[model samples]
Target chain A: MSYLELSNVKKSFGTTIAVDDFNLSIAQGEFVSFLGPSGCGKTTTLRMVAGFELPTSGQISLQDKNLTYLPPNKRNVGMVFQSYALFPNMTVADNIGYGLKVTGKPKKETNARIKEMLGLIHMEEQHNKFPSQLSGGQQQRVALARALAIRPQVLLLDEPLSALDAKIRLELRLEIRRIQQQLGITTIYVTHDQEEALSLSDRIVVMSKGKMEQVGTPAQIYTSPETEFVANFVGQINLLPVKVVSPTQGKVKVGEQILQAGKFGHLNGNPIRLAVRPEELNHGFIEGANNLSGKVEAISYLGSIVRIRLDVEGNPISMDVFNERKLTIPSVGDDYQVTFPVEACWII
Target chain B: MKTKRINFWAFFWVVLAFLYFFLPMYGTLDFSLRMKKGVLSLLAYQKVLADPQFLASFRYSAIMGVITVIFSILLFVPTVYWIHLKMRQLRPLVEIITILPFIIPVIVYVFGLIRTFSGPPFQLTLTPFKTDILMVAGYIVLAMPYMFRAIDVGMQTIDVRTLTEAAQSLGANWAQILFNVIFPNLRTAILSGALISFALVIGELILGDFLARPALGPYMVEVGRDMAYQPAALAIMSYALTWICLGLITLFSRSNNNQRQILGR
Candidate 1:
C-alpha cells in the first residue's frame, strides 16, 4: 500500500486551472520531486499536499486516512520554504523547537529533540545564534531542522535552495539528500531546476500547464521521455521531425534516409518527432549505428563538456562531447557526422 | 575643494536647523530655572511635581496611554496580518480607513464620539469609569494611523504567507502563529508604534477637554493658564517625554536593523 497518496487532485482558481487530475502514490521513505517550469502548478500541488491549499476535487490520504480537508496544523505535515522562513527572533535551537513547543511537547523531550536536530543539521555549536546571525545556508539548514523536529508524517520542500548562492545550493542539496536518507522520511521537493530534481529525487513527476506530463525514475525521465514536452523540458535534446514509414516496425523517414525509433504508435504515414539526447549522439560513425551528417552552426565550450549546434537539412540539432585533452574541437560551418545507436532515439 | 565647499554648506544648514529647533527649548529651560528670582533653581519643577492634581492627572494619562497601546496592538496587528496574508486586495481600503483618524480633526471626532456614545443606546460616559473607557477608544482611533502604518511596513519587510504556512505546517494554529512567530518578528515595529501612541495620548488635549476628563493634557493647560514658571517646566517635561520616546524608537530600530543586516535581507 502507498504511504501517501494524492488521488485525481485538481485545483482551480476562479476561471483558471492551477492543477488538474494530479495523481501520485509515494512509498514511505521515498523522495519524490515535482519538476516543471514556473507557473506549472508544481508548487501549488505541493502546497495542496501540505494543506496550504485545498483541491477543487479529489482526495489526499496518508496511511489510509483522508487528509484533504484538514488544516495544515492538524495534518502533521512539515514544510520548508524557499526563503528559509526561520523565525527571526528565535535562536536556532528555539526555532527548531517551535513545532514541538506548539504541539505541547514536554520541555525535556523538546530539548532532546532540538539537540538531535541541531546535530542532524551539523550545527551543534551555533544553536544559540538567531536566524539573522546565520548564513543563508545555515538558516535553511535550521529550517530543515525545524521541519523535521516535529517528526512529521511527510516533509515538503518548495524550492528551498533557490535563494542561495550556487556553491551553497550545491552543498545544501547534498546535505538535504543526506538528511532525508538518514531520517528515512517521506519527502516531496518542488523545483524548476532540472538538475536539482534529477539529482536529488528517487522519482520525478514532470508537469506542464497543470498536468503531469510523466512520472518515472530519474533515469527513465531523462532517457525515455514519453512526450515531446517532457523531452524538451528535462534536458538538452535534439528533436527532428520525421514521417512514419511503418507503424508496427517503428521505421521513420528523415529527409531521404530511413531510421528506426524505439517505438511508434499506430499512426501509419503520419508525421512524428524523434527525440535524442545531445550527449547520446557521438562524433563520427561507428559500426551498427545510425549516422547523420549536418553543418556545424555553433560551438560552445562549457567547462566539462562542449556543445555543438548543427543544422541538418533545415532542422536544428545539438550534440554534446566530453572535453578531453587530445580531442579536436570542430569549427563552425564544418560538415560533421554524428552517430547514435537505434535505442538512443525515441519517438515522442 | 568642491567637496569641502559642499560640506561647509551642509554644516551651515545643520547649524541653522539646530538653532531653529533648540532655541525655543533653550529659552524655556532657562526660564523654567528662574522661579527663585535672581538665582537659578528647580523650584518650578518641584512645585509642578508636588501637586496632587498633577500626579493624579499624570497617572491617569499614563494608564490611559498604556491601555491605548494594548488595545491598538490587539486590534491592528491581527487586522494588518490578515490584510497581508489573505485579503491583500483590501489593503488600500484599510489604509484609507486607518487614516480617517488623521484626516478628520480630533475635535470633530471627539464631538461625534460624545454625541453618539454619551447619550445613546449605550451611554459609555455615564460614569468616570465608563468615560475612561470611551476615552481609551478615542485614543486608539487617534493612534490607529501610526500603529497601522508601522505594522504594515513591518509586514511588508517579511513574507507573511510563507511564514504563516511554515508555522502552520509545524502544528501552530492561528493564535500560535500570531503570538509566537509574527509578534516576535514585529517587535521593533510594534514598539515604535506603541511609543508613538503613548506619546500622542500623553499630549492629547482635545479629547480630554471635551470629555471633561482629568488627563495630563488638560492639567497642563490649567497650569499654563494660572502659573508663570510651572508651565515652562511642564512644556519642557512634555518635550523631554516625547524626545525619550523618539530616542527609544531609534534604539530599538537600530538593534533590529543590526540583526537584520546579518541576514542581508
Candidate 2:
C-alpha cells in the first residue's frame, strides 16, 4: 500500500503550467528522488507534497487524509531547502527544537529530541553554536536535523546538498542515506544532479519540462529507459539514429551496418534511435557480439575511466574504457573497433 | 602620487565636515557652561534637571518614544515582510507612501493631522488622553520612513520567502514564523529603525506643540523662549542623545560578529 500519494496534481502560475497531471504513490519508508534539470517541475512536485504550494487541481493524501489545500503548518511534512535556510538567530539545538516547541512539545522531550538529532548529524559538540558559526555542510546538516526533529510523517529534501562543496556533498549525501535508513522515514529528495539521484534514491522519477519521462529503479532507469529524454538525462548514452528493418527480428540499420536490438517488439518509428551506454561497448570484438568500426576522435583520460570519442560513418559515439596498467591509449587518428552484445543496446 | 592626491582631498572634506557639524555644538557647550558668568559651572544643567516640569516632560517624551517605537515596529515589520514575500508588486507604491512623511514638512503634517482628527466626526483631540493618542499617531507617521526602510533593507539581506517556507513546513504558524524567524533575523535592522524612531519621537516638537501635550520637544521650545542658558543646556543634551542613537546604530549594524555569519558570503 502507498503511504504518500499525489493524484493528478497540477500547478500553474498565471499562464504557465509548472506541473501537469503529476501522479506518484510512494510506499512507506521509501526514499524516492525527483530527478530533472532546472525548471523541470521536480521542485514544484516536492513543494506540493510539503504543502508549500497548493495544487491547482487534484488531491494529495498521506495515509488516506486529503491534504490538497492544507496549509503548510497544518501538514506535518518536514522540508530542507537548497539554501540550508537555518535560523541565524537560533543555536543549532534551538533550531532543531523549533518545530517541537511550536507543536507544544514539553521542554524535556524537546531537549531530548534535539540531542538525538544532533547525534544523528554527528554535531553534538556544535549544539550551542549558531548556524552562521558553522560551515555550509554543517549548516545543511543542522537544517536536516531541524526538519527531522519533528518526527514528521514524511520528510522532503529540496536539493539540500547543492550548496555544499563536492567533497562535503558526497559525505553528507551518504550521511543522509544512512540516517534515512536508520529511521526508515519516507523521504522525497529533489535534485537536478542525476548521479546524486541515482545513488541516493530507491526509485528515481526523471522529469522534463512539466512531465515525468520515466520512473524506475537506478539500474532500470539507466539500462532500460522508457523514453529518449530519460536515456539522455539520467546518464551518458550514445544514441544512433537507425531504421527498423525487421520489427520481429529486432534488426535495425545503423548507417550501412545492421545491428540487433534485444527486444524491439512492436516499435512504431521508422528512424528510431538505438541507445547504448558508453561502458557497454567493448574495445575488441567477441564471438556473437555486434561490431562497429570508427576513427578515434578524442581520448580524454579521466583518472579511473578514459572516455574515447569516435566517429562512425558520420555519427559520433563515445566509449568508456576502464584504465588499467596494461591498457593501450589510442591516439586521436587511430582506427578503433568497438563491440557490444545484442542485449546491451535498446531502441528508444 | 594618485593616492596622495586622493588622501589630501579626503582629509580636506573630513576637516570641513567636522567643523560644519561640531562648531555649533562646541559653541552651545561653551555657552551652556557659562551660566554663572566668568566662572564655568553646570548651573544651567542643574536648574534644568531640578525643574519638576522638565522631569515630567522628559518622562512623557520617553514614554511616547517607547510607544512609538513599539507600534512602528509592530506595524512596519509585517508590512515590509508582506511586501517582500507576497505582494512585491506593491512595493513601489508602499515605498512612496512611507516617504510621504519625509516629503511633507513636519508643521504641515501636524496641521493636517490636527485638522483631520481634532473637531471632525472623529474628534480624537477632545481629551488629554485622546490628544496623546493623536500625538503618538503623528509620531508613528513621522517615523514611518525610517522604520519601513530599515525593515525592508533587512528583508533584502535574507531570503524571506524561503525562510518563511522553511518555517511553515516545519510546523510553524504565521505568528511563530514572524516572532521566531523573521523578527530575530532582522534584529539589527529593527533595532536601527526603533532607535531612529525613538530619537525622532524624543526630539519631536510640532505635533506635541500643536496637540498641547507635555512632551520634551515643546518643553524645550518653551524654555528657549524664556531662558537662555537652560535652552543651550537642553540643546547639548539633545545633541548627545542623537549622537548616542547614531553610535548604537553603528555598533549594532556591524553584522553582530557572533550571531550573523551569512552563508555563501
Top candidate when judged by lDDT against the true structure: 1
lDDT of each: 0.92, 0.91
Task: Pick out the ten consecutive residues of candidate 2 chain A with the lowest summed lDDT.
Answer: A262-271
Candidate 1 global lDDT: 0.92
Compose the digit string of candidate 2's lDDT tens values, residues B1-265. Answer: 9999999999999999999999999999999999997999999999999999999999999999999999899999988999899999999999999999888898888888888998879899899999888888899999999999999998998889988998998888999999999998899999999999999999998888888889999999999999989999999999889889999998998857677636642
For model 2, give the RMSD to the true fold. 1.6
TM-score of the A chain in candidate 2?
0.98
lDDT of 1 by residue, A122-153 (tens): 99999998888788899999999999999998
Interface RMSD of 1: 2.4
Over 4 Å off, model 2: A265-269
Candidate 2 lDDT over A147-257, as tens digits, reads 999998999999998878899999999999999999999999999999999999999999998898888999999889998888888789999988888888888887888
Instruction: Give each model a TM-score.
Output: 0.96, 0.97
